[model samples]
Target chain A: MMKSKHIPEEQLVDYLLGNIGEWDAKQIKAHLYHCKKCQYLLSDWQFLLSQDHKKFQPSQSMKDRIQHSINQMEGKSFKRRTVIGKPGLLFATIACVFLIFYSVHSYYQDINTRNYEIAENDEIPPETIQSAPHTQQIKVTPVSEFNQINGYVWVNRNRNEMLLEVDGLEELINQDYQLWIIYMDNSIDHEILPTQNGMTRMLFRDIDVDEFKKLKASVEPRGGSIEQTGPDTFIVEFQ
Target chain B: MSNDQENIQLLKDIAAGSRQAFDIFYEKYISFVYQIAFSIVHNHAEAEDICHDVFLEVYQKARQYSEEKGSIKAWLAVKTKSRSLDRLRKNKPLLIHRLENLSGSKKMEPGADLQFLHSLEKHLIVEALKAIPIEQREAIIRSYYNGETHNEIAMTMKKPLGSVKSLIRYGLNNLRKQKALMQWVGIDRGEKK
Candidate 1:
C-alpha cells in the first residue's frame, strides 16, 4: 500500500482543479517544484482546460441578464455627497473637502511665487521658468546659473517649505532619493534630513530663517545620512 | 479585448452603474457558465436556470470582486459549481436516494457507465478518448465520470477484483501518457497548459 503521506498521482489532477484542501495543496506545490513528472502532468491538465474553453461559450441573452442585475445593485449602493446627513458624518465630510481644497490652493500659491522670483531676477533665462506651470498666487524666480543642474528646486516662502522636484533621473535598482539640510554657520558639514517619504514628495519643516537661506538639497540612498552632500541633486539660496 | 481584462473592466463598469457594459459582460460569460451547470445537472432546462441564478448572484456581488484572490473565470466557476450543487441537492434528492439504493445492483455494463461522460467540449474529449485503446478508455471513463469504485466495477463487469484494479490503474496511466504526447506535439496548446 502506498503511504498516506505520499500523495497519490491521481490526486494531482483534482488538486489543480481547486478541489483539494490546504495541506494537500501545499504538498502538491512543494512536490511540483522538484518533480518534473508532476509538472508535466499539471501542464497536460492545463492544456485540457484550455481546449475545453471553446466548447463553453456563453450565450448573448444570458450575459445580458447577469449584467442587468449587476447594474441595479450598483445603482442602489452608490451615494453622492449629501448636504443633509448626520452631524458627525457631515462634519467629517466637510473637513475632508476643505483639506483637499486647501492643499491644492497652497500648492498653486508656492508655484506662483517661484515664477515671480524667476521673472524679477532675469538671472536665470525666461526659458527655464517657461517649463514650470504658471499660477496666480505666488511668483517664482529661477536662479540663472543653478538651472544648469539636472533638477528644479522651488521654495515656498509662505509655508517655509522647500520643494525639490527631479526629472530625467535614471532608474535605480534598490536605491532611493534622500535629502540633507546644510547649516548657514558652516560649522557642521550638513545635518542629514529626511525629505520626501518615497522620493516623490519632499517637505522640510521648521526652517531657521538664517540656516534656511543657505540650505541645499542632495539625493542619497536609504536614510540619506552617508556623506554631507557629495554632488547636489539641487541647490537653492533663499532670497 | 482580452477576455479576462474585458470581463474585469465590464465588472468594474457594472459596479459603477453602467448598464451597457454589464449587458455585454453578461452576454460573454453566460454560455460558459450554463455549460458548467449543464454538466453537473445533466438536464438542459434546470442547468439553464442554475446558470441564470449564478449570474444573478455574481451581478449582485460585483462590488465584492477582489482581483488579488483569483481570476474572474475561476471565481465564476466556483460560484457556478456551488450554485449548481445546491440546485442538485434540492432538486435531485429522490434521484440520489434511488441511486444509493441501487448501488448494489448486479450486472453492471460498461456502456451504461459511458452515458455519464459529457464534456462541454464534447468533440475534443471524444476525440481524445478514441485515440486510447478501448479497454483502457472504458476503465478510465467508468471510474472517473461514472464515479464507480473499483469493487463496484469488478462486480458489475463480472471480473476478478485484481483485474478491475489493474484495468483502472493501467487505463489512467495510458491516458496520462497520451496527454503527455499531445502536449509534446503542441496540440490544444492554450491557457490551461
Candidate 2:
C-alpha cells in the first residue's frame, strides 16, 4: 500500500502565495484535504499575522460627539413614536375630533333651525313650510358683528307662498324688524312686523320667488321705511 | 451579573431601542473597538470615524447578534477590522494586489474560535511577536500589517521567496507557542522577549 506524503509545512505558505507550480499546488491541496496538522498550521499563520498589537486611546471629545449624535437620534425617534405610544397623545387626538364634530354640529343646527324657538302650544300656520310641497330652504347667515342673530326663508314657488323666520336678535324699543326682497330687475319690496322678545315668524301668499335675487333683514322705525335706515341683521342670496 | 450576561443584556436592550444601554455599551467597549480600528487604519481621525460607524451599526443591528455565534468583543473587533480595511482600500486602490494575495492566502473562518483578548492584554501579542526571531517577525508583519505580498516582502528583505514563506510559517508557529505558554502561566502582563 502506498502512503500519502504530506506537503512540507513551510511550502504551505508558498501554496498560499500562489508561487508553487500547478502540479505541486495540486498535490498540496490534496494532502491538506486529509491532514489536520497541516490545516492547523495554516490557520495559525493566518490568525497570528492578522492580529495588531499597537494600542490607541480615542479622545474624550470623540466619545462625547458620538454620544451626542446618538442622543439626538433617540430623541427624534421617541418623538416619532409619541404619537402612537403615549396615552396623552391619544387623548389629545380624541379631544380635537370631539371639538371639530361639536363645532360642525352646532353650526349645522343653527343654520337649519336658525335658533327659531317655537313654543309647543304655538299654533302652526294653516299653510306652514312643513306642509308646503316643493319648498326650497334658504339659510340667512348673520352679517359680521351680528353673529348672535339667525334666520331662514322658505319659498314654495308652486303655491306662490313664502315663510320667513328670524330669531336671536337683540330687542329694540320702538323699532320693528323688516324684511326686504330685492328683485333681479333692481325693484325692492319691503315688509315690517312686530317682534316680541327678539323673534318673529311671518307667512305670505302671492309670492313669486323666480323674481327674487336677495333677501335682507334690518332694524327699522315703528311703521317701516321705503329704504333701510338701520344696521343690517342678516343677508341671504338665492341661487 | 457576569460580564458576558451583562453584555448580552446590553445588546438586547440596544435592540429594543434603549439609549441608556447603548451608553453603557459605548463606555464598556469603546476603547477596545477604537484600538482595533486604529491598529488597522493607523490614523486617529479615520479610526474615530470607523468607531462611530461601528457603534451606530451595532445599535441598529443588535438584534442580529446572537451569543451562539461569538462574544460581543469579538463581534466588535471584526466590525472594526472590516471597516478599517474598507477605508484602507478606498484610500489606496493600488494595494488591491496585496489585498488579493492576503485574501487568497489566509482563509480562516470569518470569526475564528480564538478568544478575543481585551486591550489591556494586547501587549501580550506584541510580546509573542517579539519572542520570534527578527527575520520571521519582519516577514510576518510586512505580509499582514503592511499588506505586502510574500514576493514583495522577499524583494524588500533581499531574501528568497522560499525563505520569506519559511520565515512566516516559523514566525506564526513561534507566536502561537509563546501565546499558549503565557496563557498557561497566567502571566498576561507584557515582558521582554
Candidate 3:
C-alpha cells in the first residue's frame, strides 16, 4: 500500500525520462513541487542525465550545416547512404576533438585545485556528539534490545536541552541514527550526530519535558527518512 | 497514436524523404545529444561538431530506429556518449579512422563497432557510479536518471542546495578519479612484460 503521499518510483522515472505525456507531465510537476521524496530521487538521476544530457550546445552555423546535410539527404531521395566529398567535415571534427579534450582536461584540473583549496580553508564543525552538555541537565537511560546498551539522556529543563550518548556500536556509513522526542502533541527528531570508535553523543535543544512522554532513536537512511516514523533501535520512557 | 508511435512515424517519414520531418526530429532531440556531447567533450565548438555528427548519423540512419530497443532520446544519448568518449580519447585518433573508413567495408574497418563502444561506455558509467559515495551516487542518479531538480534533491536530502551542488561536483570528480584508475589499469595490462 502507498501509505505515504510520495509519488511511486515508476511514475517518477517515466516523468524524468520524458516518457510521460503532457497531462501527466503537468500533474507530476505539480506533485514534485510538494514531494521531497521524488525530488531527492533526482539527485540520483542527475548523474545519468548530466552524463547523458551534458551541458554542451551546438552553434548556429553547425545547426545550419546539419540542416543543410539533411536537406541534401532528402534531395537524394533518402537513400540512407553516407555523404562523401566533405573533407572539411572530417577536419572540423578533428579540430574539435583535440581542442575539447585539452580544455575539459585542464578545466577539471582547475576545479580539483579549487575544491582542494576550499577543503583546506573550510572549517570542520565540531562533531555533534562532542558538544559539551549544558549546565542545567536531567538524566535518563535509554532501553535497547541489545544487551550491551550504555547511554544517558540528560535533559535540561531550563533550556529544554538534552544530550544523548551511546557506546559500543559501530559507526555506520550512509546511515543515521536520529533521536525523536514524542510529545503529547507531536513527535520531533533532533539533529544527527556522527559516531566514532564505538561511541556517540548529541545535544538536543528545545526539548519540552512537560509534554515529553517518550524518546526514540532509529537508524535510518543517510538523510533520515521522509516519514517521522521508522524502525526504532532504542526507546526511553520519560516518566 | 502515442508519442512513441508519433516519433516512429516521424522517423519513417524522414526515412521516406521528408525534410520537414527531419527538421522536426532535429528540433526534438538536438539538446539531448548536444548537451551530452558538450559535457563529455567540454568544448562548445567540439560539442557542436559532435552534435552535427550525431544528427548526421540520424539523418542517414533514421530507418534503423527501433522502439523495441529504447526511446529515440535514449538511443541518441547513447550514440552521443559513445561518440563523446571516442572523441575524449583524442590520443587514439579513432575519429579519423572512422571518417576515413566511413562507407568502406564492414569487414576491413579497423575501428571498434559502435555497439561495442556503447557497451564499454555503459560499463564505465556503472563502475563510476559504484565508486562514488552512496549519498553522492544517490543524488546524481536522482537528478539525472529520475529527472529531479537540485532544489528537489536539497529538499529530499534535507540538505541545502549548495550542499546538493557540492555532492554532485564531488561525485563527478570521484567518477573522473575512478576513470583515471580504470585507464591506468588498462595501461598496466597493456604494458605487462
Better of 2 and 3 by TM-score: 2
Clashing pairs in 2: none
- Alpha carbon lDDT of residue B131, candidate 3? 74
- What is the fraction of true interface contacts found in candidate 1? 0.17
User: Candidate 1 has what TM-score?
Assistant: 0.31
DockQ of 3: 0.12
Categorize the docking of model 3: incorrect
Off by over 4 Å in 1: A1-239, B1-3, B93-193
lDDT of each: 0.48, 0.63, 0.57
True-structure Cα RMSD, model 3: 28.2
The order by descending lDDT is: 2, 3, 1
The count of residue-pair clashes in candidate 3 stands at 25
> Number of the top candidate by TM-score?
2
Q: Kindly report which residue stretches of model 2 are placed more than 4 angstroms away from their true locations once superposed.
A: A1-55, A75-239, B93-193
Model 1: CAPRI class: incorrect
Candidate 2 local lDDT, residue A204: 59
lDDT of 3 by residue, B88-192 (tens): 443223332332233243454333234433443445456568877999998989887799999999999999999999998888677657534343223232232
Against the true structure, whose DockQ is highest? 3
Query: Model 2, range A127-204, lDDT digits (tens) per residue?
Result: 376456798888888987789887787888887666777788776654657777776765666655435345667665
